[model samples]
Each structure stands twice: as structure tokens, then as C-alpha cells.
Target: MTNIEKKVIDVTGLSSDQIAMLEEIVAALKAVSQTNNYQGKVSLDRLEETPQPSLTLEQRRAFLQLTLEERRRLLAQQAENMVEHYQENTEWQEFLAGGIIEY
Candidate 1:
């Protein structure tokens, strides 16, 4: 295989569809980085210094009104939904089969 073809298949065990999607996402990120003149360094310290929208007191109060159990249940449901969504992708099933380690 040519180097281009070899690079495309570097991600072992993924379906062709998954590889195509991955390539598209990678291309998009590369385009964004080039257009924005980004050096590709990911630093959360810079992000922390960026101004973020603040929640109003009422909005904060409403968000905090959920009981701990209610919050946990909501979080669990969201997690389940995300897992199900990923599970529908054959590539994700292969990833899960290999197991994932979270940092």
C-alpha cells in the first residue's frame, strides 16, 4: 500500500465508514487550525482566562434546585443515552470491545 493508504488504515479495526468520518473530522479540524492560525497547543489556562457568560442569580438558583438524587438520575439517564448512541455505531462497538481507559 502507498503511504497515503497506509496512513488511512492506521486506525486498526475500524469500519471503512468510521475511517471516512474520522478523516472528515480531522480535515475539518486541520482547516480550522490553519484558518485561525492556531499553533495546535491545547491549554486550558488560556481558556480559563477567556471571559465566559455568567449565570444570573435566578438561573443559578434554578439549576441548584435539583436534589442530589434528582441530579444523579438525570446525569445517569444522559450517560445511558450517550452510550446507546455510541453503541449504535459499529466502530464504537469495536472500541468498547477493546475497552477504554478514562483519564
Candidate 2:
């Protein structure tokens, strides 16, 4: 069998929670992946339209001001989920590599 097929066959035993976490990671990865090849300026107008929780002005501003480093650290937490998912379902390795999920 091909390497990816072999990997998928190997990952059939994942727990439900593990699968869910992998899905979440995949979503986050997709969101950040655009940065890898960005060539145009990003606008904040869309962000301004999105409704957030009932934070005070200061709290909202603070959250908006988070540094890229801080965002990366937060995003890295998704890796923990990815690892757990992989351990539970070895076949997920293929999913990760295929962009079906995140690595």
C-alpha cells in the first residue's frame, strides 16, 4: 500500500475526543496557513463587524492588541491536541499531512 494509505489504515482506533480535537487543530491551522503566502494587506473591517463577548472596552482592546508571539503560543496549544489525536489514531498522520487536519 502507499504510505498515506498505510498511515490511514493505522489510525482507525482514535477516541471521539481525540478526533474532535484534531478537527479543531485543523481549523486553526487553516486560519494561520494564509500567513505562509500572504501578499496583500489584511484589513480589520471584518473583525470589527464580528460580535465578541461582553468584554469591557479595555479588555477588548487588550485582546485585540495581543502580539503575534502570544498568538503563536496560543495556537501551539492545538499541537498538543494534534499529538494526542495522533497517538489515539495513528492513521491521523495521513490526515495531518494531507491538510485534512493539522500537524
Candidate 3:
């Protein structure tokens, strides 16, 4: 039997088909991991959960005092952070599985 090699991947740049391929590989791993003592399952629930953040009083005050340009830069950074965590829509999974989600 061959060993499975795993690597840390940046999923943000992966297309939907690449994401689907990863999912199928994971499912196969989980199936093989089952034995007399254990059954493995993975949850993708966080895909739908939105992040919740609360600022401390000092942080809020600092944010409020930022100049317009500084605020724009900060907001742009925050938006990019959010987009980096975005989930692929479910409807595209089938198309993705075929490895050609787009023409």
C-alpha cells in the first residue's frame, strides 16, 4: 500500500473543480481510515458560518479616530480577509466534479 502525502494548500485560489477533487480525496481517506475501532467524519459547517467580532473600547476608539485614507485602507484589508474565507456555492459542486466549471 502506498502512503498518502498531505500538504497545506491555499484554497482561496483553487477553482471549484479543484475544491471538489480535494473533497473526494478526503472522503476516500475517511473511508480508508475506518477500522475495528473508529469511524471518521469531517464537517464543512464553517463554510456557512459568518465570523463575529467585537472590538474592545480602546480598539473602537482607535478605529473611530483613524483618518479617511487610513480607514479606507483598513476596510479594504478587512474586505480582502473576508473574501479569502469565502465558500464555494453548493450548486457548482456537480460542475466542479467534472473538472470544468467554466468554459
Winner on TM-score (1 vs 2): 1
**TM-scores of all models?**
0.30, 0.27, 0.35
Q: Candidate 2: misplaced stretches above 4 Å?
A: 1-10, 39-103
Off by over 4 Å in 1: 1-61, 91-103
Best by lDDT: 3
In order, the Cα lDDT scores of the candidates are: 0.45, 0.43, 0.46
Over 1-103, each residue of candidate 2 has an lDDT whose tens digit, in order, gives 0011111212367677545554454454444443323212223566222222243454434434444664466446546545554465444455566754558
For 21-79, candidate 3 gives per-residue lDDT tens digits of 55554454345433311111123665343333444454545555544665576567545
TM-score result, candidate 3: 0.35
Candidate 3: list runs displaced more than 4 Å. Answer: 1-53, 87-103
How far is 28's C-alpha from truth in model 1 (Å)? 30
Best by TM-score: 3
TM-score for predicted model 1 compared with the true structure? 0.30
lDDT of 1 by residue, 1-103 (tens): 0011122225677677555555554454345334433222234667432232444554344435544664565457546645654554355456568646766
lDDT, candidate 1, residue 82? 51
**lDDT accuracy of residue 30 in candidate 2:** 45
